[model samples]
Target: AHVITHYHRTIDKVTERFLGKRQIGTTGRGIGPTYADKINRVGIRIQDIFDENILRQKVEAALDQKNHLLVKVFNRRAIDADEVVESLLSFADRLRPMVADTGLEIHRALERGETVLFEAGQATMLDVDHGTYPFVTSSSATAGGAATGSGIGPGKLERIIGIVKAYTTRVGAGPFPTELFDESGEFLRANGFEFGTTTGRPRRCGWYDAPIARYTARVNGVTDFVLTKLDVLTGLSTIPVCVAYEVDGVRVDEVPVNQSDFHHAKPVYEEFPGWTEDITGARTFEDLPKNARDYVLAVEAMSGARISAIGVGPGRDAIVVRHDLLGAS
Candidate 1:
């Protein structure tokens, strides 16, 4: 019944200043720096905010190196320690009530035969340890991260559900094998409204890369997939799916082991017949067009995970559920 909020974002500064022109295109929300502080053992916690002296001391210590980098390296204004401390203190009364030992609570709940769900931010391709490397986020984004990020044990997590868009889209820089430069990419972007939910940045659209989906499924031990935005594929004459990648004259069925190989990977496409009918009103999987049903089955076979649910439209009830996600019979 409780949620765990890891790391602190009392300061808004990030390591983007260090990246210079070769920036990884972060959202500039200080997430990188906050996680950096956690690893560096200098991060302030939610509990620290309640103690005025401890809060001020930690903020001052963190800003000591940060302000130096901003002023000398980035040529940015130095952040005042008092201002940062004061800003954090202002949220103490409001956040204190919500703060709890979420990990312990979740563990206890599961011990009592209650269900505990662990949701994650970002995608597997954006994981810091296992993803596209320098182009990834600051933390672990895969299922393995769920154990470390939250204080829950990995054995307790029996199911890993991956939510995938029917078509591919990426917000920032990375190696994308299926990126389309023509009208087809634009059509998906426009119809799906492919934009970053928080930053509003336009996402790069592409065809579904089954190889990438399979790679994620393998890495995360995904049991089921919730396929989304299937309705946006409507009205197209044909749909090209990236079944594999051609890297350096060789067909790579799996994700390349090295970043260089991934960057140069070329998509090997498998074209499927498209549907022209509007399927937003479809309530069941059987209600979908035969071509659409075939496409879903083909993707499921390639993805290495069962398609438990399919999102046909934007509404809450638009999902076509095939199985219970909670493992209930």
Candidate 2:
């Protein structure tokens, strides 16, 4: 578990600023530092807030080192332990009612034959250990993480459904092999509304990268894929899908083992005929246009997972299910 403080954000800003051009494009929300504190055993847990002395001691101990780094190394002001303690303690009353042994509760639900759905906050490409190194999020963002984060046994888990867009869009900085720098990029960005949910920054748009999808399927053991934003690519003459990558002029069928190779990889595209239909009202797979159905089938064949559902529009009910998500294998 990770806990965040005011100093954590400050630390994030300072450290990132120090790194200059080489900074990892984090949200600057103190997530990385909070995780670092947890690993370093200097983190403030939620339970510590109920005890003022324990909270104060932990805060002081953490600040003892952090303050030195701030002042001596970063040339910044030291954070006050008292201020941090007071700020944390302020949320105790509201948090007390919500705090529980969630793992135990989940187990109880499982024993009662109730369904439990674990939703990850980030994508597989942003997973700490399995994703692109240093460019990934602070923790695991895969099916295995669902068990670890929820304190559930790995053997008890089933049905890892991957949600992917019709095309690719990456926020912040990283190597995107299929990234578009032309009008096609702008067109996808405009139609897909490719913007960050939190930052409101315009996303880097690209053609669908099937190699990355295949990589995700292998790593996460994806049982099904929910293809979203299919309607966005409606009027294109032809849609390009990256079936493979060319690293140093050598064609590779999957993601590279080395980060340098991945960074330099170029997309090998396979063009799919586009559709001109308005698919939002379509409730069944049969209602889709021939070209749209072909595109889905082609992507599914390459993606290494059955596409269980296809999102036709942004509405809650704007989906066509080919297979049952909870009932099917």
Instruction: Give the Cα lDDT of each candidate.
Output: 0.85, 0.93
Error of 2 at 287 (Å): 0.8
TM-score of each: 0.94, 0.98
lDDT of 2 by residue, 1-110 (tens): 45699999999989988988888888888989999999899999999988999999999999999999999999988999999999999999989898899999999999
For candidate 1, list the clashing residue pairs, or say none.
Answer: none
Q: How accurate is candidate 1 locally (lDDT)?
A: 0.85
Model 2, global lDDT: 0.93
Per-residue alpha-carbon lDDT of candidate 1 for residues 47-143, written as tens digits (9 for 90 to 100): 8889999888887897788777767866767878787777778888999899888888888998999987778889999999888988888888899
lDDT of 1 at 316: 99
How far off is model 2, as Cα RMSD?
A: 0.9
Ten contiguous residues with the weakest lDDT in model 2: 1-10
